[model samples]
Target chain A: MNIAVLGAGNIAWHLSKALIHAGHPVKQIWNRTSEKAVALALEIGADSISTLNQIDTDIDLIIIAVSDEAIESVAKDLQLLPHQLLVHTSGSTALDVLLTYTQKAGVIYPLQTFSKAVQVDFSQIPIGIEAFDEGSTQALFNLAKTLSTKTYYINSQQRLVLHAAAVFACNFTNHFYSIAQELIQQSGLDFNLIRPLIQETAAKVQQVLPQEAQTGPAKRNDQLTIQKHLDLLKTNPAWKLLYEQISQDIVKMYSKDTSSLK
Target chain B: MNIAVLGAGNIAWHLSKALIHAGHPVKQIWNRTSEKAVALALEIGADSISTLNQIDTDIDLIIIAVSDEAIESVAKDLQLLPHQLLVHTSGSTALDVLLTYTQKAGVIYPLQTFSKAVQVDFSQIPIGIEAFDEGSTQALFNLAKTLSTKTYYINSQQRLVLHAAAVFACNFTNHFYSIAQELIQQSGLDFNLIRPLIQETAAKVQQVLPQEAQTGPAKRNDQLTIQKHLDLLKTNPAWKLLYEQISQDIVKMYSKDTSSLK
Candidate 1:
């Protein structure tokens, strides 16, 4: 299948490479910055376009792999035939945003973090697909299958929740590591000491439920150790509050007392 | 060197197994429950003692791998010769706690979560050692070197900070996964969809700093997406509050202006 990628960012770079490697021909690549677009196009053997209007109407699929805010504007600027499918690769953006510009619209959101430096294994990364109609859905699903082994037909509402959950699981978790790094650095200790613990925690969740895998002073309701940690964080009021709040939440979860409503 | 394990808990099981595997002789295994002690002792070809008085004075090293609250009592109960070294496998406990029980006291705290069900490779596990004197410190260091490749001479204050950091990086991070799992389960979406995302997020930290690796609506400061997620979380006040707090913290971190304090 012939496809046109509409971005020059990390996601676009990785997605275009994966699609090309999967035997799909990328016909055109467009970005607001022509340098990045030209570089990506040359790498993927695709035509470099400076504007959305330069995209050919003959392409079978047009994947708008731009930022969430740019999806609608990019869709409005595109000049495509009604038969050509247009989809935005965003987890938060609603499908209706694409329908405003084209009748044949869909979403093929890859539910994983992408980095230009990192080579992602698309085979395990989940691709969530949603389309305006049954035929377009099948086409997007078929295309997604070529790039990933795990594909799901997710609606807009479910995708929103998935994105939120990803924020907590991925984004928030990374922030926790940052906090850990700060704590160790302040104590004049190497942050690399905690690397194995971080990896092991993630690995444990793969086989066991996170609830069951939970351990530490909070889970054990050891107030003494908790108080010690809180006192240690006295210099940083923000961190102290965060530690107190999360510890309270964990204590509540394990206490089996739902008197205090969540 | 002759070693006696003072508990049959998860840490004791793993530590004893690793010590034995490293060619160090486990002279005895003792626990309040004789059955568990016997099971672990038989597995590692060591004597199982039901009472603390049964501990042989001939042992070179005594490792008290009990709960934080029981460490002092276990140390008080141990009957060791003057030259024999004593240690507790605790991160938060100070080196002085062990010195109260024996002149030759040290610590061999492993900075990783352990489980009886999961087998761990000690090569990557960081062993934090602290002792009352230089000679005991060297002796404990030699013992730790046998079980782990990563050994550090961390003082009591540093170990306290390290333990606190582990809570943020491992324990609190796992709680975030629990929150994500809860959210996805409520939405009737497979939690497995986010598993790859979780793994990738952890993997990113191995190469890049967590501060630089952070991504999501929070990091992007996309208030619209944040508000939408907040609206979806209205029914669950506990989660809603958590979501708001963490998102606010992330936004504060990325926003150059320090006017907004969380």
Candidate 2:
């Protein structure tokens, strides 16, 4: 299927490249800045369109892989082909927002955080897709299948929930690393020392349920160590708040189980 | 070298199994509980000793792979040869703590989290070692080198600092997952949806530094989305605190560069 990408951000740049590599023709590429669109198109040997009005209605799909706030406006500007499927690559935005403009509207969200500097292996990334009509849904499903082994026909509600989970799993988790880096720097240790532990912790969850895999002061209910960590974080409000919130949640999780065992 | 293991916890169990697999001579294994000691020894096909008095002082090393609080007590109980190396597999405890009891003292900390159910590949894990004397240090380093491809000559101060970082990287990061799991549960989404995101976030760090590879609303400083996420966590005070703290940190980190550019 020929695909037209409607943005020039990280997700768009990576996804367009992956599609081209997977033997799909990118019909057209467009960005608010025409140069970005031209650069990406030239790299992938696809046509570049400077304006949404220039987007061909004959294309199979128009993927608006822009920021959450930018998607609605882009959709409003694009004159959709009578039967062309329109989609966005946002995790938080609802599908109904696209449905209002086109009967052949859907979502083609790739469930991985992407960056242009680091190439993503789309074959391993899960793709969440939804469409208002069966024909459009099947097209999106097949398109996802070509690029990945896992594809889900998730609805708008589930997509938003998945998006929220993505925030915790990816965004919030990165914040934890940043905080860890900050704390380790303050403690006068090389960040390299914790690299193995970080890699192993993430690797462990592949084989174990996260709840069963938890190990630490909070998991052990060791209030002494918890207090020590909190004391260490006192000077930095970010670390202090994070330490408290996670500790409290851990306490609540364990307390529920502790009472049941009694 | 004849080795004696003085604990039956996660680290002790895994390290002992690796030693036995590598054809090292484990003289005996001891634990507070006779059953745990017997079980561990049997698992590695070594003898189990219920009393520290029964340990062979002629052994080359006696590793106190116990909890931080129990290390001193265990070290006090062990009677060893004058030249025998005494070490503890702890990141927080100082080597001096063991040096006070034995002339030959050192540390042999494997920088990975271990679980009894999972068989860890020691060859891939990094081992941190330190000793009081050059001879003892070389001996421990040789022993560590035999078990793992990666080894570090880390001092007491470095070990403690590394341990604190491990808490932030592994312990606190897992708490982030717990928070995500809770959010997904509330939103009525399958917790598994976030697994790919979690895995990719960690995998990306291997290719680039954390500072250079950060993303999300917080990193981008997109106030609109940050406001949305904070609002989502408003009901959960603990999560709210964490959200605000991390957001502030992100703001502070980016503000520096943003201001410089202005």
Candidate 3:
């Protein structure tokens, strides 16, 4: 498909490069700041567009890769035709956000974090495709399949749920790591000591359920060790709250009387 | 050094095997339950003893890798000479526990989790060593260096802190995985979609600090998306409490007002 990309952000840089490498024509790139677009277009052999009106009308697809709050505005400003399929690469935004601009609306949300300098293995990242119509959906699946081995048909609600789940799995999990780093640092220990343990904790869940992969004082309900940890965190109110809440929940989950959980 | 193991649990199973593989002579194993001791001893080519008196007095080191509460009793039961070294593989227990029984006390606690079915690379696991005296500490350093590339002279207080840190890094982090798994499954989505994201989250921390690697609504303080996620967890009181506490902490840590955090 002949594609034009809007915004030169992290997602745009990685996704556009992946698409072009997968033998698609990513012919034009546009951004509010044209220098970013120009720089990226230069690297990928595509033309840079300062104005949305400069996007090729003959392009089969135009992707708005801007932030969620900017999606509707970018969609409104884009110059489109009746035939061009329009999509946004946002997990939270609905395809209907683009309906005001065109009837040919779709979503191709990659369920992974992207940073400009990081080299992403696109084949390992899962793509969640949703569209207002069947043709547009099929177009996204085809576009997505070129770069990834996994693609699923997910609606807007499920996409939102997945986004929330990602926040817990990726964002919240990293925060726990940050807490661990803080605790270790306060004790004058190198953060490097816990790195292998962090890696193995994640690796363990890949082979088994997270509940079954669980190990620790809370999992075993060792109140003695729990109290020792609590005493250590007595001065840090924030960490104390988190440790207590998380440990209590873990104990409740693993305890025989799990009647409240389900 | 000729070593005798006093327990046949997770730590004993992995550490003794690593010691044997490193060509250290692990001569005898004894546990309260003789069957467990026999099973582990057979696997590691060591003698299993039902009575502590049956242990080889010629052994240079004795490792008490039992439960933290049991460490005191086990130390009392072991028969050791003035020249022999005795250590407990517990992060929370102190060298003082052994001081009651022997003057040659030390600790060699591995800062990693072990399961019966999995094969752990001892070279990657960090060992935290503490001893009552210089001679015992030197013996532990030499013994630990044979199996692991990383070893630290961590005193009892520091070892306690490290143990709490590991709970956050490994056990609490896995519980976060469990929470993510629950959220995804509750939405009728497959948990597999987030595995790659979880792996990358951990992998990013290995290269950079966790604070620098943090990404998500809380990190950026995106209130709109945060509200949406909170709405989703409104029915789950346990999850709701955790979400609110953790997100609030992340926001406070990242927000411009540097009032609360150190």
Candidate 4:
């Protein structure tokens, strides 16, 4: 399958390589910054296109792996072929972002975070696909199947919901790490010590629900320990407030039936 | 090594088995509850002692895997003979918890969170060891090395710091999962959809630093996405407050400059 990737971001960088690895012919790549596009294209052995008009109409699929806000604008600019499939890898943006511009538009959202420096195993990554019609959806699903073992034909609304959930799980959780780092630094300890625990924390979720698996001062409703942690975070109002807020949230959610400060 | 486990909690249950699997003899087991002690002792093929006075002086090590508040009280009840090494599994409690009653006291803290139902591979888990003296410390280190491939000779101070950090990375991050679950539920999506992502999110930190591996709306400072998430979470005030607070914290910490949001 000949593919045209129209973004040079982390998602594009990884996706292009993944496509190549899966034995797909990446016909062309394009980015606002021609250097990045050219660099990625060179790595994937694909032709680099500086303009949307330069994309080959004969390509089997065109995947716009740009930012959420840029999807509509990029789709409006790209002169898509009559029968060629056009898909964007934005989780939040509806498939209609593509559908409103092209007859054969879809979403090919890789449901994993990507970093150019980090070589992720796409086999483990789940790709959420959506298309304007069942035929196009099947095509996107088939394309996704080649790249990843886990492929789901999720609708635009479901994709948005999943993306929002990703924000909470991925984005919010990383913020917790950042806050933990700050607190550890303030306590005069190396942040490296928490690495194992952090890794295990997520690993545990596979075997147990987060609510049932939850532990520590907050879950146990140990006010003394919570107060101790709160006092420790006194220097950073942001962190103190966050600690207070999350603790309350935890108490309200998990330990509601049990004894709690709230 | 003849090991005596002195608690019947989650940590003790896993640790004793790990020690036994590592080719050590679990000589005796004791707990506040005689039945629990007997049960655990029978499971591990060790002697069950109801009272501390019944403890055998033949064991090479007596491991106190009790609670922080109960450690000192339990230690006072136990009478250790000379040259018998003693250690507590409490992360926050100092090694000195055993110092009052015994001459040779140390700490052997497993940096992984344990639940009764889930069995952890001790080979991958990092154990933080602390002892009052050099000789005792070496003994604790050797014992920990037998149980786990990753053992750190961390002092009491470092253990406390690590414990606090674990609460942040493990406990607080679990709360983040709760938040994600809550938000996804509010969005009318199944929580299971986010479970795989939740597991993968924590798994990523093992390979990359939290800061470098950070992603999502907050990391990008995507105000539109943040506001949209806030809007989605508005029905749930507690979650809304959490989302706002964490998003703000992420922006303040990771954003290029702190000029705005000031």
Candidate 5:
């Protein structure tokens, strides 16, 4: 497969390399900042193009891995033939943006955070694939399979819901880590102390249901310890609110009958 | 050191097995329910007692692994001598709870969630230690050192704060997992799809600050995606509230200058 990448962000940087490693030639790399494009392209052995028009006509796939808001603008700038499939690597984005410029539009959201310095194992990462037509869907599944063993045919609405869930699973969970870090630091304890607990909490979910993996005062419905935690968070009123409210939700979850499960 | 465990709960069950595995002869196991005490004690090669009064005074250390609310009650029942030390494995309950019963009061709180079915590596777990006096402190440290290489001399107040912080890092984080699981399940997508993302979110914090590891629309101040998520979560008003407020806090965190840090 001949691929062209649009953007120099974390996803673009990593996905371009993974494509080349998987024996798919990344034919072109383009970014608003030509210097970044050139740097990434040189590292991945792809040609850096200053403009989308410079992309070769024979490129089979075009992957736009820019910010969610930038997806539409990047799609508008690109020109593709019927044989070329254009896809955005965003869970929150839909297929219509790319379909506006080309009949062949699709998405391959990696559903994982990326950093320029970190080399992630592509084979283990889950990819969500959606496309406008049967051919595009087949092409994307083929491309995604090269990078991952886990791929799902998620539609536009489902992908949006996945993004929302991803925030709770990743972004908001990291926020809890930050809150925990602050609480630990305020008491003159190292944040590293909670690392193993934090590691195991998430690891447990890999094997069990999050409901089954749940523990602590909230899960036990221990009101005394719950009150104690609320009292301790009095200085941080916002965190106290989260502690109280989330704890209440957990209590309700486990306390309720299983007949009402969603 | 000879040890006596005063409860047969999750922590008590695992800690007893871990103690026996560490070559400490658990002198006795007691619970309000003699059957449970007998069941656990038999598993770990220890005698089970119907009443805490039957605990051997020759035992060097007494461990009360009851619920936070029951810590005081269990401490009151235990029979000890001047040479015997008593400790409660609770993060929220102050050392004073045990002090009311004996001067050899201390705390050896294992800062991890445990299940009787799963065997955790005590060597890697962090144990928080606190005691009523210098001698008890040294003794508690000695005992904690045997269980883990990572033991901190935390005081009663710090232990409360640690418990509070732990609820954030572990309890609240797992609650987020439950919320995410529901969201994914509602969309007919498997919860397993988000496991890798959850694993990486926590694992990243082990090596870096949570602030540095933070990502998503909130970190980027991508208002469009944030609004989209909020709109999607309107069916679950509580989750919508969490998604909105937590994202706002995250936006403030990364946007603020260094001078305002806590």
Candidate 6:
């Protein structure tokens, strides 16, 4: 299949390589910065286009792997033939956003964090596909299947929820790690001490429900230990509040008490 | 080394098995519940003592692996020889608590979440050792080295901070998974969708600083998507507040403005 990748960011760099490795040739690559576009295109053996007008109309699929805010603007610049499919790789933007540019619109959101420095196994990552019509859906699904074994047909609304859940699962989880790092650093202990615990905590969730995997003072409702931890955070009022509120939330969750602490 | 394991809880169950695997002969096993003690003792080929008075004076070390609240009471019950070492497996409790019972007292706190259902590789788990003197410290260090490759001489104050950090890295991180599960379930999507993301988030922390690993709307400061998520969570006021506060905190963190939001 002939494909053209939009943007030269982390996702684009990874996606282009995965697509080319999956036997789909990326015909053209474009980015706001011509240098990045040229570099990525050279790396992927694709033509570097300085402007959207130079995008190959003969391409079978065009994937806009740009940021959420840039999706609509990128979509507006596309000039696709009736046979070509256009899709944006975003979890938050609705299908209608792409519909404004062309009737043959779809989504191919890769449900994993990507970094230029990190090489991820595309086969293990889940790819979410959404389209306005059956034909585009099938094409996107087949395209996604080439890059990943785990593919789901998620609609815009479900994708939105998944994105939000990712914030809690990925973003918030990483924030907790940052908080742990800060606390450990302040205490003059190596942060590496908690690495095993972090890995096991995540591994436990794979086999059991997060509620079942839950352990610690909050889940056990050990008020004395909780109080001690809160006391330790007295110098940092924001951390103290966060620790108290999250602890209270966990206690409330396990105790099945609906009483609002606020 | 001759060792006695006190408490047949999850930690004790795993610790005792690991000790036996490391060629340390467990002299006795005791729990408040005789049945559990007997069960564990029989499994590990050790004698089960029904009373604290039955604790063998010939044992080289006695490890109290009970709850934090019961540690002091358990210490008070132990009939140890002057030459024997005593240690409690607790992170938050101060060394002075054990000092009240015996000058030979120390800590052998294992800094990993344990479960009876899941078998963990003890070699990967970090064991924090703290004692009143060099002899006991070296003794505990040698004992810990048998069960785990990762061992540290963390003082009581450092251990307390590590305990608080564990709350953030393990306990609070699990709570975030729970929150993500609840949100996804409410949206009529399978919670499994976020499992891969959770695993990757934890894996990323092993290589990079958590602050460097941070991603998503909060880190990007994408207010539009943030507002959309906040709107979606409006029905659950607690979750809405959590989403708002954490998002604000992430923005504050990367923005480098030290002004507290609260």
Docking class of 5: high
| Segments in model 2 whose C-alpha atoms lie over 4 Å from true places | A183-189, A231-235, B185-188, B260-262
lDDT of 6 by residue, A17-64 (tens): 999899998999999999999999999899999999887767888889
Candidate 5 versus truth, CA RMSD in Å, comes to: 1.9
DockQ of each: 0.76, 0.57, 0.76, 0.54, 0.82, 0.77
The number of the candidate with the highest DockQ is 5
The digit string of per-residue lDDT tens for model 1 on A119-153 reads 77999999999999999999999989999999999
Off by over 4 Å in 4: A181-192, A257-262, B82-85, B96-103, B182-196, B256-262
Q: Give the lDDT of residue A132 in candidate 5.
A: 90
Q: Which candidate is the best by TM-score?
A: 5
Query: Model 1: residues >4 Å from true position, as ranges?
Result: A257-262, B257-262
Candidate 5 segments whose C-alpha is farther than 4 A from its true place? A258-262, B257-262
Indicate the residue-level lDDT of A78 in model 1: 80
* DockQ winner between candidates 2 and 3: 3
Query: Could you give the candidate ranking by TM-score, starting with the highest?
Result: 5, 6, 1, 3, 2, 4
Clashes of each: 2, 0, 0, 0, 0, 0
In candidate 2 chain B, what residue range of length 10 has the lowest lDDT sum?
A: B157-166
User: What lDDT score belongs to each candidate, Candidate 1 first?
Assistant: 0.89, 0.81, 0.88, 0.79, 0.87, 0.89
lDDT per residue (tens digit) for residues B128-155 in model 3: 9999989888889998999899999898
Better of 2 and 4 by lDDT: 2
Provide TM-scores for the models: 0.96, 0.93, 0.95, 0.90, 0.97, 0.96
- Candidates sorted on DockQ, descending: 5, 6, 3, 1, 2, 4
For model 4, residues A131-205, the per-residue Cα lDDT tens digits are 888898888888889987888767777777678778877887876776677656766766666777787788777
Candidate 2 on B86-200: residue-level lDDT in tens?
Answer: 8999877788888778879999999888889877788988888999999999999899889999888888877766666677778777777777777777767666666777888
Name model 6 segments beyond 4 Å from true.
A257-262, B257-262
Model 6: per-residue Cα lDDT over B82-201, one tens digit each: 898989899899999988879998999999998888889999999999999899998898889988999998999899889999998999889999999987887788877788888998
